[model samples]
Target: MESTGGLRERKKLRTRQAISEAAIALFLEHGYDQVSVADIAAAAEVSKRTLFAYFPTKDDLVLHRIADHEIEAARVVRGRGDGEAPLDALHRHLRARLAERDPITGLCDHPQVVAFYRLVTGTPALQSAAARYVASGEEALAAALRETTPGDGRFAEVTAALAAGQILLVQRALAAANQACIARGMSADEREPDALAEADHAFGLLSGGLAPYRR
Candidate 1:
């Protein structure tokens, strides 16, 4: 029964993937607003109800990919090795993703990945949705840090915000830069050397204490 259930879950995931891919292709070919949920449902060969079951909102169809990354920061903060600071764990994770060319880093140059990013960043609604998703991630990670790091309870929220903001801002800036370079016709591979340099520079600012300037 468990195996049967597992198979059923896998089938559902595949169907979801198919629908998402079909929706993206349609959005890329036509403008996002020009396409409707009905259009994506038809294109994916799924009923409208099926698409809605997988995706709650029209914005969700495009920005659901953003959700893939939503809890990543919180997870890293929660799961850091003994004696490892939250920021250290996050930094290490990001550097590893840079080496791995993870799509979340905007460092994957595959045509489909490029198109998906172009579609997301090019569409205003998707961009707004992505921003909110990222902000939610920051908030979640801030909560994680507040709970995990031992310190004064009174200042926890303020300190967590500072820590989370510094880390997430650096990451978002690096990804945006990579996207811009790709937009200007540079392959992720072609831009990797510079991307590495940018990461180093950005993180260095945090390590050197960016918050001091604001105070």
Candidate 2:
């Protein structure tokens, strides 16, 4: 039998999923700004208070998926293989995700995923939330760099900031390009080769520029 803690966690997961699904349906149908947190909570059969307990802001309801990825850059840096350059590790991760057609790679053309892309692109609030996601990734990546580098000075800080910004710029560019392809009705699989090539090019630029300063 599952422990009480396990059961509570499972129940919480179910509630969160229900809330997210209901929120998505309303967001896609009526537009994000037109939908209220009250609307989402009512649709999910939860109280406004309960909904707020899970997601602090209206933006969180739609952008929690982005939150799921907030720590990914830091994880990539810390988990790189022995003898692997950090940018090389990141490049490999990006290539594998694009090849696998991960939705966050911006190559997935599945209906729900496309709807999410549309919702995010079409909503100002969601766009702000997405920006926050990128900002969080940059901070986490910078902290990881500062911790790992030889010194704890401004040089390490500036280098980390620049490197983090460059890596995220590459990711944003790739995501936007792939999203454009999806918008034009190309399947993610059909876009894989071009996307992979672009990933290589972007990372090649980063590796060449950032590797010298990396420790």
User: Which candidate leads in TM-score?
Assistant: 2
Candidate 2 runs further than 4 Å off: 152-154, 213-215
Candidate 2 residue 185 Cα shift, in angstroms, is 0.7
lDDT of 1 by residue, 66-178 (tens): 78789899998789888776666777788788888898998888888888888887888887777788789889988887887566768678878887887887898899888
How does each model score on TM-score? 0.90, 0.94
- Put down candidate 2 lDDT per residue, 2-87, tens digits, no spaces: 99999999999999989989999999999988888888999999999989888888888889987877878789889888877677
lDDT agreement with native, every candidate: 0.83, 0.85
Q: What TM-score would candidate 2 get against the native? A: 0.94
Q: In candidate 2, what residue range of length 10 has the lowest lDDT sum?
A: 206-215
In angstroms, the error of model 1 at 25 is 0.8
Colliding pairs, model 1:
none
How close to the true structure is residue 174 of candidate 2, measured as C-alpha lDDT? 92
